[model samples]
Target: MLNNVAVAAVNGVTPFELGIFCEVFGIDRSAVGLPVYDFAVCAAEEGPLVVGDGHFGLTLPFGPERLEEADLICLPADRGAPTREYPQPLLAALHRAVDRGARVLSVCSGAFMLGAAGLLDGRRCTTHWMHAPALLRRYPRALVDPDVLYVDEGQIITAAGTASGIDACLHVVRQEQGAEVANTIARRMVVPPHRDGGQAQYIRRPLPRTACDTMGEVIAWMARHLAEEITVEQLAERAHMSARTFARRFLAETGTTPYQWLLRQRVLLAQELLESSDETVDAIAGRCGFGNAAALRHHFLRTLGTTPNAFRRTFRGPQAA
Candidate 1:
């Protein structure tokens, strides 16, 4: 049902994020039996729009009126500072699109434009974890969850960082066309159909440089031994520190306890295995150090709010089940 699509082009838009919108919706895949959207990049102002470097620019054929025909509108991240104001015409078109029941999606800091449009007010949304604080300060009425890769608030979808834009697009495809279509598109892109966890697990929240001499080395060792059951006492021995000091330093450096970090790593590994391999739940559970299917299920549900098998089905299809 989501056939028409439009990407709002603003000055200072990041070329890569804008290309994500073009890649997902602008391309014609109808020969392979995929939906072909009526897509265009629309500019708020009429004339040559300057981009990143002032020397280079784009000339969009359509204007903000094009957004009226779109079933979905994509806002790619702009390099303009988060505090900069978007064109009022572009924001008004966005408001009209949503008022007519169309969906709007933002990639990374594009959430700033949505916030400017007042679309994110009182809604759960997200942007890149690095910019989440600024977004929260700018739009206090908006509920920002920096942990997740993306947040789907019915008509509005806000995604984190560059690649999560693909994930968010594929999610909309899966919702509209089903898992099979989404999987096929992902295959064409050579990216995972789905990924687990939030940007929390991916953000490089490393220990302080001073502390990394000891804690960092242990963290690297822990990553290598994710499949093995690790105890903080054993880790303390390995670090040549007492249990209390090890625990204290672990929290200070990693911002999480040893057990919590290990559990998150295990869950992340399980997710990768579930998406990439046809292995049974028990096999994956053991491989990820969960020991059994039930344990994997418990942790998967706890972390992702879904069972492993269900997650697999959502990504790999029912036949995989």
Candidate 2:
């Protein structure tokens, strides 16, 4: 129920993931009947902030003073930062925020910061894929699930690296503002509204339904009709099963819920288009059944934790942008 969010733009700000915080939670969406946040970008040391890839320098009038007012405090990822020694002043501010009922979050390696502070001593969290092992090794007391995009533990949350932060942010939105508002933001951002964590993270080979028969027809249909209005009942009817029966069967066969399976297909298609096709995000969203670029961005953030542009840059090679 707090209105403001203060995101820490630490040294060597990964501009893209930090920007995800701006897009999802920072910008006012009240006109669209979504919750609005009082967003401020603050630096530990005020004035000229250096960004990744020599992007831009930013300055903020307020430093950590804004932390006292924040309902949520964000620390963007730092791949190169220390795992065990977060500065004392920042840790104190984080401790103070948490003590006062504010939630503290980190993106990717930002979990390292929280872990180092001893806050994650008994919590479950995640970080970027590459750093997950190190994080778990560094904090054995921390239960780290490396494959999921993000983890939500009510008062505290942590996300997988980079774009996974966006997923964590959307999760917050859904919790605070409800599914409708979260969907609206997703529409505006051109991203998928929700992607359940149960979806496959490393689906190298698509699992077939059986040795002879397959749910192949249904999955293809689901992917093709992503923009169409779908319901459990609708899908169940297509498969000639009752809703209850189909829900159970779907989870058993696909290892995820019906809605989640559709979302994963949409994300996969979007990833392909984002990589192989030269289409803009908006066009890709429409093509991939996300409705718009905003909707695509929402899902992309949830699954990948980075913006379309940023993802494209990385996909095209580190130097593309």
Count the clashes in each prediction. 0, 20
RMSD of each: 6.4, 12.2
| Model 1 Cα shift for residue 175 (angstroms) | 1.1
Candidate 2 regions with alpha-carbon error over 4 angstroms: 82-85, 198-321
lDDT of 1 by residue, 1-321 (tens): 899999998888788898988998888899999888899999866568777556588999899999999999999888884978888989888999999999999999999999999999999999998999999999999999987889999999999999999999999999998999999899999989998766764454432233477787788888888889899999999999999999998888878889989898888888788888989999999998999999999988777767788777767897887
Model 2: lDDT equals 0.75
The sequence of per-residue lDDT tens digits that candidate 2 reaches over residues 1-321 is: 857899976666777778888898888777777777898887765457767655677777878777888999998875355443556667778888888999987987888778777888888887886777788888889988876878888777998767667778878888877878778888898877765442123323253352223455676677668767779888878888889998887777677888878777777777777777788888889877788989888887787556676766656764543
Question: Could you tell me every candidate's TM-score relative to the true structure?
Answer: 0.68, 0.61
- The per-model lDDT (C-alpha) reads 0.88, 0.75
Prediction 2 TM-score vs. true: 0.61
